[model samples]
Target: MLDINNALEDKLLGFIGAGNMAEAMIRGIIRNQVVQPDQIIASDISVERKEHLSSAFDIRIATDNHSLIDQSSVIFLAVKPQAVPAVLKDISANTGAEKLLISIAAGVPVKTLAAGLPKGPRIVRTMPNTPATVMEGAMAIASDSPARPEDLETVETLFRPIGRTVRIEEKLIDAVTGLSGSGPAYVFMILEALADGGVKMGLPRDVAETLAAQTLMGSAKLFLETRTNPGQLKCMVTSPGGTTISGIHELEKGGLRASLMNAVEAATIRSIELGKA
Candidate 1:
């Protein structure tokens, strides 16, 4: 667990949708003792999902969204982005000022969420990457004015066990979505390319993949542990006229850095467009 302190205290945690991300959070929170299984409640439209969550985690299941909102102190708006409006409309009357809502729906702005609910609803918006399922995610959190400092801290506690969390302005959320939210796919593609390179050098397919993945993992670990500038680390690896420099030359020729920057920029623009929609 990245954060060991239990922040839920006596507050009951609820999930409006019991999907993969919600299940991952449930698994992580239970595994880390962030909250007792009984301290949680989740509701899903699917009966099979409700049964699976109950049997898998031994937590109480809400009969519907309204019941979940009525029972839970802190609620996670974990439904699909397109379903958020309907869910909000259904629960608006039941959700009062006392309740704090944290949303994980991508590209849904805090203003949009607030517009769907009653006046001055306490809301926090967050973007967490797919790696959260494995407890290795990077997440960014932003809160509206109605959300107190304690609310933000409580939100942090719920997410910390699942991965690392950072506080950011809501305006920067599109950039975060472009970067970390979509980052794993980019990394996976790089890994595949690296494995292909190794295969081109006559290595077995499995061995190539293993070596490529380990290299990427170790490089990331080294950078994080040392906190060294990546360029300095790259320079350290590239002795003059060496094999690494030779590879670097090819990467530069292929415009790798520019391509990655363009990818992030494009994604960010698309996120902004989606938010407007």
Candidate 2:
């Protein structure tokens, strides 16, 4: 393991972008006290964004990307997929084999990242979701062949404060992107639909929204705390001749379950296609 406690003490963390996902991780790290503000640095093209980050987090913000890479031991490539190639090319000369690089850009593969960097540099590719904004994300990571065990641990520690993380083969990352990366939006849509149903039943909008959100949170917590299968949990809430069962039947009749399954499948396929693109 990288010894997260030790890594944060001696290492400078760098981010190549100051966008929402990057900003969320920065906030999470500081809020959790995993890294002191001084230990983290960021660079972005926008002067306003740089100033905003500086004011918001009290961390060093560089106007140029090279300066950020030059000063840090661990660098996070948090830029969008389209921006990655140019950013990587810009930093390739500055990043040596010793530095650990973590990338959260979706649809960009580890091998692609490695090819863009100096040979033998440690690279960790991760897929993190929008829920990271709320510190409740699901993330998956995969390390390049040259990545050391400690390097992988350092990456895991960085994300731990944000949400649950898992290590998987790089090949599985696209599936992770489909299931969790885009999954939050799916859940949000469901929550909206549930709230709409509540409103249709004469419940006030605010109360219905609150109940829907809480119900989702509570059900998720139950699954986590009890470590029970979702099917079993659903059964527990459902009575043979009651409202829960009645609602479930309506959902089934509406092809909700099948639609969800197809939706996830479509997302997975689309992710693969995007990566190939």
Candidate 3:
């Protein structure tokens, strides 16, 4: 793990694309009080996007790629996978040793991003989920060959405010994409199902949703605070011939565990496919 003690205040952080993920990160950084808005800048091809980001985040907006690259030491490649090549080409002329690049573009490898530049910027590829919008996300970070120890630390420092972060080997970034990247949707499905079960048991719609959400939240908190493995926690809750045990039996019968594993596997394969593309 990289050091979290390093401050992100030393350099300007720029977003090359003003999109949802970019907005989530900006919201997270600002909400965590990492730096003043003036220290951040973003550029987008869309006039509407530029306006929205500038107005919502109160950060400077650059009219062109070159201008943003000129001003930033740490730049985020937050554009779509298809858009990456063009943007990389556009910024190549100005990229330099002083810059560290962080990319959140899904399925676009670090090699692909670095390929467009002659001498590439130290590159870090990241996988962050939608929960980052609320600053409660999970993220995985990986770096290219040119990246240094300090570069990894800088990447971690940039994302630490967003949510929980982990550094993984570049090869497993696809696995991270499968587990945490697509995992939020799986979690949401679980939440919805739990809520539905509550409603089936006679709770009102709103009350059922609240109870389900709180249950998951409280359980997660307990797991984190007590540093207990989930199996241990589950065993602690499950009783001899009790309702919880019955529910677990039903879940097992339905192959919930295998289904989730398969879901992650399928998603990982898809990520690999995208990377190959």
Candidate 4:
């Protein structure tokens, strides 16, 4: 908690693109009371979406990027990667030393953003997952050369209320994009598999789904809170020839661990390729 109240005083938090991720961050900020809803502003190409944002969150909305930029000190680059170049160009003239530019676009490198202008704003790039919608996101942040320590702190303060934030080198962002960025889908698949197993074992579909989700959530929370080694936790559940051990044996035989590693590696390589393009 880096005193966001004082740090964000008189500064309007703005989003350049109003999409799901932008809405999530806005909800998190308002839910946590980091700043009042009135202090937030967002711009979108669609007037309907902007109106929805204003009506849903009680925040200000601008119809164009420049109008939003003129009113904001901390700006979230929430547009798609394909749209970044043009959007950055559109806003570059107005961006400067005083504004903190944070991008959540996937696979767009910090260098690309810095080169958006001859002298860029203090830029910070981030890879944030969809769990941010629930205020439980895992976000990895990296900064360009022009970004100072305070700039990173500004990003942390902005995101801390939403979920966990970590500082990492720019080079690792693609890998992060592979892991946490794409990881929720992997977990969703696992959750589906678990629910299917429960269904096959005679549980109703809805009950199985709840059990599958809650079990994973509880297990993750317990591991994080206790800082317990996963292997040890597995052993704790496994008795000599117990049902848990039998299930574990089946999972190991099915090569679950290797499959997950391969999935992450494949996704990471794809992310790198996207960055290169």
lDDT per residue for candidate 4 within 171-228, as digits (tens), equals 8888888899899999999999999999999999999999999999999999989999
TM-score of each: 0.90, 0.93, 0.92, 0.94
lDDT of 1 by residue, 1-277 (tens): 3232343445578999999878877888788777789998999998898899999999889999989888887889988787888899889997877788898877889888888887455889998877777777899998543588888888888778788898988989889989998888999999999999999999999999999999998998899899999999999999998899999999999999999999898888888887777
Model 3 steric clash total: 0
Report the number of clashing residue pairs per model: 0, 0, 0, 0
- Residue 272, model 4: lDDT of 79
- From the highest TM-score down, the ranking of the candidates is 4, 2, 3, 1
lDDT of 3 by residue, 145-217 (tens): 3688888787777678888998887888889999998898998899999999989999998998998889987
* Candidate 4, lDDT over the whole model: 0.86
Scored against the true structure, residue 127 in model 2 reaches a CA lDDT of 89
Query: Residues 80-107, candidate 2, lDDT per residue (tens digit)?
Result: 8889898988898978887788888877
Instruction: Give candidate 3 misplaced runs (Cα > 4 Å).
Output: 1-11, 143-145
Q: Which parts of model 2 are misplaced by more than 4 Å?
A: 1-5, 8-11, 143-145
Assess the local accuracy of residue 184 in candidate 2 as a C-alpha lDDT between 0 and 100: 89
Best by TM-score: 4
